[model samples]
Target: MGGFELTLDTLRDLAEGAAVLGTGGGGDPYVGRLLVEQQLRAGRAVRIIGVDELPDDALVLPCALMGAPTVFHEKLPGAAGIVTALRTLEDRLGRRAAATMPIECGGFNSMIPLVLGAETGLPVVDADGMGRAFPELQMETFAVMGVPGSPMSIASDHGDAGIIDAVDNRRMEMLARAVTVQMGGSAYICDYPMDAREVRRTAVPGTLTLAARIGATLRQARDDHRDPFAALTAMLADTIYSHGVVLFRGKVADIERRTVAGFARGRVRLTAMDDPGDQMEIVFQNEHLVARRNGQPAAIVPDLICTLNSETGAPVTTEALTYGQRLTVYAISTPRIMRSPEALACFGPAGFGLDDPYVPVEQLVGGP
Candidate 1:
């Protein structure tokens, strides 16, 4: 084991890093960050285990909060939420949760386990289920690899708990979302329990580490007066990935949203500052799924669609996006894990009502 501790410094770094990579989906870092920091102050240890070191027999679980990405502002679940989920799930499985993995690479997902780790005794893995947030829970790597979403468990702030078992991963996500709404718009969940064998095949390897790197680079670049986006572009280029320019920089001009299909389906309009006549609309189901430039298809699923602040350029979560908020639309290639034929089937064009061709972000960006 390289290390068996989650330090304050590391937690701060992770929080900042996660926020930058949230890709306009995961909840903000400040809320989850403060929660986890408080727990650490109380003296807790979160561990990290290399994916290869996980025992084939050991059971791995991904921990996270589930619900409308919007609920955080009205009724904060408070810091105790994550520990409640972790402990409850540990008991349900009747086995000690060997280690913890983030469900996604974004702010809240990475921070949830850290907060719980201080209250409970589980260590956070240097990994996550999804490299980035997907609108649906089933969009995680676990689902892409056919890992069952249950037997899973969730806990709400009201002390209500539920054990979920579904026939398929998508059904499980739908069931869980409905239950979360009833629990006041959010529920803490511990799911995707699988043996190390399955974990090795499905989970994005070293995603937490990757997030940390991206996070650190952004900060360092900013200090050097180097463009953060340009630095990100270079990093992706080094990896043979492609990225697009500032699509439109302005404030949200309008929003049309509804709670349907057990998910938040909405459209947010961004008024352009550079091009006064141009406007962009972002359509999402939990994560940003599509982008429209002046009512025409700009990018759709299978390609990574994300939005960020005009100046900060950090992620702008679906929940946080609203009218009068300055922003910039962006695109990047999907993680290789998500580009597979099987992956495209679930989260690609058809999944999001995208009628146009699902071009790779690289191709759309005019390639490397």
Candidate 2:
């Protein structure tokens, strides 16, 4: 498919879909939708182009918001933060960025680049570093494929800006996390500078389009009085995320949340309203990592653990969960590229301090 122009209607759909893919991380997409909507109203037309359409020599910069999602609820990013970071990165690189891509294709990070593209007059590539949102900077296909995360630029709504040149992606994440904490716990970043060829090879293709489609499908399902959960599973089954299953349907029983080391660290307990004896637990560090049913492992990180409001079919972020809220939890498979042993080592349950081994969501769910 050719490039598509983004409109307010589609932006709403993209935001909803992206939140589903966020897996309880990446902050809320509503904030991002509002930012992009403002740009659209100001007459900026952002184009989403397929990776295949990009010229091989084009320079593409992956962009995102970093730090604790909880911070974003209190301190909204400046409208110019992403654009400033993009310009700063281009200046540091000594060349203009031909386009901007999302560092991840879930939640606010997914839409930030579109707003940046509208403001900077750059096309937004319809691809991203992660097929879904990940909690850390290094949990990306670009970093896994040997792309450097720096020289990176970060800008805060507080008018602070800084450049970081780390020896590697891990160091980049560490240094950037320090800077974000100093920036009041949230900042925008432009990193993973790559040519079109590298982007095509390293990025998860068509995730932007997938987000939009997922949003549209959910809307249609609701309008037609069909099961939104069923619609979601069918849609995901057709994509690289070939399996999606509801792990549990219940009400929140308890929560233990705290911000530690610049990340939202916590776990939530759920008990089935219909079967009170059936219980599940989910652990998270910015994103949901491991899910267990009746204390047995049901899903692990590197796979998605998505929570949705049982009634409205809307995604529920980690910070948004509360006791007594009825919810449905779903688990989806990560992309094949992200499930490799090397990639698993970087984002698996063990990476988050859990002792369980990595397992694909499909295996746990017994197929799509």
Please provide TM-scores, in order, for all candidate models, with all chains considered together: 0.90, 0.98
Predicted candidate 2 versus true structure: per-residue lDDT over 142-211, tens digit per residue: 9888888899999988667889999998899999999989888888999999999999888888899999
Query: Of the candidates shown, which would achieve the greatest lDDT relative to the real structure?
Result: 2
Candidate 2 Cα misplacement greater than 4 A, ranges:
none
Q: What is the C-alpha lDDT of each candidate?
A: 0.72, 0.89
The local lDDT score (0 to 100) that residue 260 gets in candidate 1 is 67
Candidate 2's TM-score: 0.98
lDDT of 1 by residue, 115-200 (tens): 66666676666666677776677877788888887888888887777688888888888899888878888888988888778888
In each prediction, how many residue pairs overlap at the backbone (N, C-alpha, C within less than 3 A)?
2, 0
The window of 10 residues in a row where model 2 has the poorest summed lDDT is 359-368
Quote model 1's TM-score.
0.90
